[model samples]
Target chain A: MGEVKNKQVILKDYITELFKESDMDIVEGAITLELPEGPNEVLLKNLYLSCDPYMRNRMNKILKIEGPATLLVGYVWGFTKWEEYSFVPSSRILFKIEHTDVPLSYYTGILGMPGITAYSGFFEVGLPKKGDKVYVSAASGAVGQLVGQFAKLSGCYVVGSAGSKDKFRFSVFVNTSKSFANNLILHASPPLHLNAYLSTTILQIRYFPEGIDIYFENVGGKTLNAVLLNMRINGRIVVCGMISQYQSAQPEGVTNLKKLITKRIRMQGFVVRDYYPMYPKYLEYVLTKIKEGDIVYVEDIVEGLENGPAALVGLFNGRNVGKQVLLVSRE
Target chain B: MGEVKNKQVILKDYITELFKESDMDIVEGAITLELPEGPNEVLLKNLYLSCDPYMRNRMNKILKIEGPATLLVGYVWGFTKWEEYSFVPSSRILFKIEHTDVPLSYYTGILGMPGITAYSGFFEVGLPKKGDKVYVSAASGAVGQLVGQFAKLSGCYVVGSAGSKDKFRFSVFVNTSKSFANNLILHASPPLHLNAYLSTTILQIRYFPEGIDIYFENVGGKTLNAVLLNMRINGRIVVCGMISQYQSAQPEGVTNLKKLITKRIRMQGFVVRDYYPMYPKYLEYVLTKIKEGDIVYVEDIVEGLENGPAALVGLFNGRNVGKQVLLVSRE
Candidate 1:
């Protein structure tokens, strides 16, 4: 078997708090070019690796899973290893890319995990009807952007919230007021009442004066508190991820949960891993939308497997503009 | 038309803080004891009044819904003038008491609002299965007792928590350690981490060490924080009420909300009103369960309409042992 150098990002140690680049080290490991002796295991040349906040929780030694090596012909955005080459079970590679007319790197985002997350969470959990008002937090991220687009495509009025002015600008279809973005930064660390500007009518009157029908929760903490107050009776909150709380030593307490009883709200938390069965159906719908140009995807790609640590760490800081991708190989 | 002295409990004014017996005035007003001129309006003598915590929120001016009235009923524990008699539309009355073979006052406890609250919250929202592990908060109160019984009837293992040692004794089938009940009071006001004892392994090991499959959330704030940490994957949290937070200036923050993502929990809030249609179906089921001694209900009945304020306020303080009912008239 021919051997090739596999450059990998190794965790230097278990992380208990906020993630740093120094927490990981670049290791030069060697991989056999051939697949392992099994009926299903395949060796793959990793192309696009996704940098997401969920990865932070799995860094704890208790939650670790072994990964790397597969002879896969196509691509996916599922878990493998943080390396240039990987050998893994064929089943571990979630969905094989069937439609290549779109960019292959799109596997890391809209055509992959984030895509199905938006699809199932919005339609299955949120159950939006026509003319419903939708609010999405972390609106320019991989999952949030798609949720906003899917809501818009379904004939719903959509409003979005993001941390920076740049994210509000980057999100083309989902509209959020610049003042709201400023307030997000301005009220980042204040007590909830002091953080009450967005939770009150000032933001509500401008965005959804009637109140929100669906709230897509990506960033938790203060934003969740505001959204809870702004939700209409029978509103649905689809909790996909809570990026804002990932870095904190202890996530801030959310105080407005009483609204859940008052409003008869249905707030559900979901993980995309349980929803892989929908990926084929999602691929069928999303591919058509992308080909027809009815939906658009924005990506911020960083080149090289060695830079994966920095790119992944940037997510909690909101440094990337869209679906953050690490380019490990081309062709 | 007949004129009679109708002793009424009138709000002194809108209350913005803790409720007191002084905030209500027992006024001797005159009632004609005749229905208003409408096809549906009717007049009737008042009997039992259910004193629960939800009325605390309705005391605010903004959420006001005019109440009191109705003629045609054997007995019911719905809203009415806290006086000797009432005149209102027949539609204003919720469910008419069809079965009075048990105590006529039961319409205020197991046969009325709290009955449906427990039934629907556990069966519909909770969706318990045989062999599942369930947890209930406020175990001796109106709703919690029935939820525990329903879980046991479904062949599931159940545990409950309440504010006082008396509540533990007052609840029937649900078994909770005395230590868990004590912690509910001990950690009542601490920060989430300092309040982490119950949220950690001590409570989990003693209770559902396998982790809770269903959590019936009656007392929110710190209790909800603890339950979230001890949930199994794919668990469901049916939030029927948040009694602990009713009197707080600002409700405490729950920090373990991240468990919602890690465990993929479905936390839902429901008001009892939406499930009223299920009342006929519920009444049928609960009646059979009660008659067979498959379930039992406890009532802490106080005499006089004048004592309503004390009974209502007692809910927040956990002074009452079971479902607190105010006996306006025994007939």
Candidate 2:
């Protein structure tokens, strides 16, 4: 078991420039299959790797580096590269896969961290009710897709904004760029000159005519500003990820925060780690939904560990159409 | 009743420039003190007028004009002038004052709108637990003063920022400008050049060594930016008011919103109206505290209705040391 060669992705240097695929170096390494001599540690084979936007923050020096490279770690840790056959501590592995009928890659996404994120962020933080008007950004991503489905299941009118219309088959697929252009044209008339600040507001009003009750914030910046204006009184904004501003030199200032007070909006940010106790419940519910065909997921799988860097970097540029997954091993 | 002279304060025109005493006009007019023929309407003499920072927004064309001139109206209404008498519709009044032993002006501050604002913003929105580190901005003002006292009662370590040190005896009164200067001097060394963004972070760290569990935000802009960086994981910021930005041509953009996700903070904005149902519970609790000498209030009273404009405008400049109140005929 100790003789097996391990392919590992290593962060060669902390990113100084906008993150690129070259920053991460894939190197061939070796690790023992046997568990280390500790009461708490366990050895397991790496199956599927997740390509998430949060990993970009880790690549830069912004996020702290710690813990094993697996789901449900005690604390948020740095990302592991396109790697295979790595031995992680026991606690790092949230729960062992017992259900084999579902794809093993689902654990890395819809059945794992992203799954719980969508659940807790939408239900707990978002506080969605029946007939709620929900708007989700990055609609095709792992978490956003699940959030929209959950909202729809709750009898909500869900609209999603994606980088491109092809990203997801949403009830209303708003191409963010085209929407902005339309907003400019609509507000070009006299007595209503729209600036970048007001333009977002005008565009969002056009998208969600009745106003949004729950905003599942996946991409922050202009999208967040736009949603702020269109939010109904007592609206809830669940901040999951700010993928758009993750690699920017300076984060864009949210100018429409005044609406928060006027509309009495609640904007809360959450990490999935905080709600790990509900993972079992979430898994049961999501698995049932998947089985019932009530919840559908879209995965953009990149074969081989070598393509991991490009797949991960593609998240920032909105290159990947869906849940970006790096396939590490068949086992 | 129609023969009585009504000293009226009327908004002569919408303000385009920075607010001044001249924005409001005082005129002697007449109104029937008798209620009009309506089942929902009641007529009462105007006892004390509350001078609040939110009124600054109404003074400009920003806030919509609606409803009558009194505290806790059905909806947030437009500003009224520095006049002695006026007839307002019955439903516009939230609740009739039942207790009279305390100053009638207390209804305008500690017992009325400001009192509930503090109660809901601190307990409901801020969600401070025992022994939590709490920070309150605009410490000496109506809402801020009560928030600090409430936090202390809850066994939380409380700190407050005020325009002047003499304004309310808080546990810690951070003179904002002085704190900023100190932050600048402390970060004069290499690798720590403080910009507008980083400077606020440094200042907050100095004030809150253990990080803040809850921030009772009243004065936003730079103060909000500062509190964001110093927020502990899962911290709550109750956005009660942004007095600093109410009169600005363009509200300052908050740049460190990414910290919301990184720190898992919940920044919620609320109006006191949402929690009006809890007014009874809050009033009883506050009245008990007042009787027990557990709470003390300070009111900066401006005598006469003519001085109302100056008192109202004084809030923007931080001129009023405490709860700014206009003595309109203390019936």
Q: Write the per-residue lDDT of candidate 1 for residues A80-140, one digit (tens) a residue.
A: 8788877667676555666677888888788777888889989988899999999887877
| Model 1 segments more than 4 A misplaced | A32-41, A65-78, A89-91, A164-197, A201-203, B34-41, B65-77, B164-197
lDDT tens per residue, model 2, A1-331: 5568888776777775578888777898877667578777644556578888877777677566431233222222223434675445455535756666777778777877888899999998888889898888777788887887788778787767566222322223432331211211111122322224334543455567778899998878867877787889989999999876877877777877888898999999998888879987998898988887777778899888788888877887667766888777665
Q: Give me the displacement of residue A141 in model 1, in angstroms.
A: 1.0
Q: lDDT for each of the candidates?
A: 0.75, 0.71
Worst 10 residues of 1 chain A by lDDT: A178-187
A39 Cα displacement, candidate 2 (Å): 5.6
DockQ of 2: 0.65
Worst lDDT run of 10 residues, candidate 1 chain B, spans B178-187
CAPRI-style grade of the A/B interface in model 2: medium
| Shift of residue A270 alpha carbon in model 2, Å | 0.9
Fraction of native contacts, model 1: 0.76
What is the per-residue lDDT of model 2 for residues B159-243, given as tens digits with 9 covering 90 to 100? 7766522232222443233121121111122242222433454346556787889988887776687778788998999999987
